[model samples]
Target: MPDKTEKDQTQVPFGELLRNFVIELIVYGILIAIYFYVALRFLANPLAALFGNNLAAYAVISLGLIVVQAVFLEFVTSLLFDYLGLHRLSSRPGKH
Candidate 1:
């Protein structure tokens, strides 16, 4: 058996990495913006009513939406990265 070396692995160019980072930022921002837009326009009043003017409930709901937005962005960006080959497959040897 032969030992694999890190030097054998492929690397992306710095420019491509920077470009990908920018793209990721824009995508995440868009997702979060959509979340806030929908939550504020549609959910805020109804939730405020349901909780009877409790500010804490709105805070909790806002935090939950943030978490959900982050998770959704992560899932979507991961899929896009995989499809676009912006990142390497984790199943590759020595990736861990």
Candidate 2:
């Protein structure tokens, strides 16, 4: 009774989904810890100085840094997921 597209769509098991979520959470936590350590260790003084010297520049630069951090973390996480043999779950049908 189902069409080809409907038949091709498969549901991921709840337990597997939960497990993957937990794994990703743990990995992200670890990466974030490292990122914080590096940022504070290296960037604290420079950012502070910039903030004190120029408020507008500091705001723009800070925003840029946040974007860079997000992109870097995402890329690292994707690589980590692949290396750990975990494939990202997709909502689209037949597109794992």
Q: Pick by TM-score: which candidate is best?
A: 2
- For residues 1-47, could you state the per-residue lDDT of candidate 2 as single tens digits? 95555444456677877787788789889878887898667999998
Question: What TM-score does prediction 2 earn?
Answer: 0.66
lDDT of 1 by residue, 1-96 (tens): 988655536666768767877787787688768877986679767976957878787779878988986798688888767665676634345644
- The weakest ten consecutive residues by lDDT in model 2 span 87-96
Q: Candidate 2 overall Cα lDDT vs. reference?
A: 0.76
Candidate 2 regions exceeding 4 Å error are 1-8, 77-89, 92-96
Deviation in Å, model 1, residue 71 alpha carbon: 4.2
